[model samples]
Target: MPNIPRNALRSLTLLVIWEMWKERNARVFRQYGRPATEIVDSIKGEALLWIKAGDTALANLLVRE
Candidate 1:
């Protein structure tokens, strides 16, 4: 696989983390009034669902292991 620059990877990681944080904060602030722990749990659950969906798609493709 091609290499990624350390700084570029770090920046991308930070951007993803920030986006997730903002999304959780917005959802809690607007509708749920939930605590930080609960908000993080919700984000985790959502991410799990996304992973499951992707896994399902790849399985359907039957790509070589």
Candidate 2:
């Protein structure tokens, strides 16, 4: 595999974490003002739809059982 620079990898990881944090905040503070269940459900539904639309890899990963 090709080598990725440390800074680049760190930046990518930070971006992902920031995105997750933002989603959590939106779900907990803005939309439902409670636990993240609703937000998680929405993400699941979106993932399922995306899988049905041909993203087999993501769909497989998201499926629970």
Q: What is candidate 1's CA lDDT for residue 20?
A: 71
Q: TM-scores for all candidates?
A: 0.44, 0.44
lDDT of 2 by residue, 1-65 (tens): 14544543454344446556768787788883545686566555655565677765554444524
Q: Which runs of model 1 end up more than 4 angstroms from their true locations?
A: 32-65
Candidate 2 TM-score over all chains jointly:
0.44
Give the per-residue Cα lDDT of candidate 1 at 34.
Answer: 64
Off by over 4 Å in 2: 32-65
The sequence of per-residue lDDT tens digits that candidate 1 reaches over residues 12-43 is 35545865777768788876456778656765
Cα-based RMSD of the predictions, in order?
A: 8.2, 7.6
Scanning candidate 1 in windows of ten residues, the lowest lDDT window is 56-65
**Predicted structure 1, TM vs. truth:** 0.44
Error of 2 at 44 (Å): 20
